[model samples]
Target: MPGLAGTERKNIAPGLAVSIVLKQDQRTGKLTEGVVKDILTKSPHHPHGIKVRLETGEVGRVKEIHDEE
Candidate 1:
């Protein structure tokens, strides 16, 4: 799913890798890849994307979830 509404918390664990769209890159629809450090979205679903903080300290909405291996 491109948006976070279809994603579940279990599917996006803290150590999982993911591609997200940062605030600065939202206009270009750029994707930043990083390991999830924290899940900021408390709601069950969001229309835009699930807000999360990466290990690198970058915060954005998850666009795609990637496997660790």
Candidate 2:
């Protein structure tokens, strides 16, 4: 929890635990927690956050990467 989660592409990877904001939830700033199944963002950085697919088959933009717990 000490380290920061960057929107840069290098900061996210498959199998990492992360919190993402789904398209519908963006207005409310909702966060969904799940293990990353894939990185959907093609760019090196995104202002809104990197898009990704979770293990649960949900796709969204990563808001924060969860530290090992």
Candidate 3:
């Protein structure tokens, strides 16, 4: 599937491209795209979104995952 990454812990992995909402941007719902550097959320699922750190060192909650074509 293309661009199908989700909030489930299993859906996110290191190196995958994804869009995330930084803590500061939650109100505006801005999405930042980057490769997954680390998965910060340890739960199986999250209502808002799984927290992750991008390769650029920006930390945020996964809002949308980008599919690498």
For TM-score, the strongest prediction is 2
Which runs in model 3 stand beyond 4 Å of their true positions?
1-5
- Ranking the candidates on lDDT from highest down gives 2, 3, 1
Task: Give all candidates' CA lDDT scores.
Answer: 0.82, 0.89, 0.88
Q: Write the per-residue lDDT of candidate 3 for residues 1-69, one digit (tens) a residue.
A: 245556788988999989899999999999899999999999989989899999999999988887677
CA RMSD of all predictions: 2.7, 1.5, 1.9
lDDT of 1: 0.82
Candidate 2: stretches off by over 4 Å: none
Error of 2 at 51 (Å): 0.1
Worst 10 residues of 2 by lDDT: 1-10
Model 2, residue pairs in steric clash: none
In TM-score terms, candidate 2 sits at 0.91
TM-score-based ranking: 2, 3, 1
Candidate 1 local lDDT, 1-69, one digit each (tens) = 543332565566788789999999999999999998999989877767788999999999988987545
Off by over 4 Å in 1: 1-6
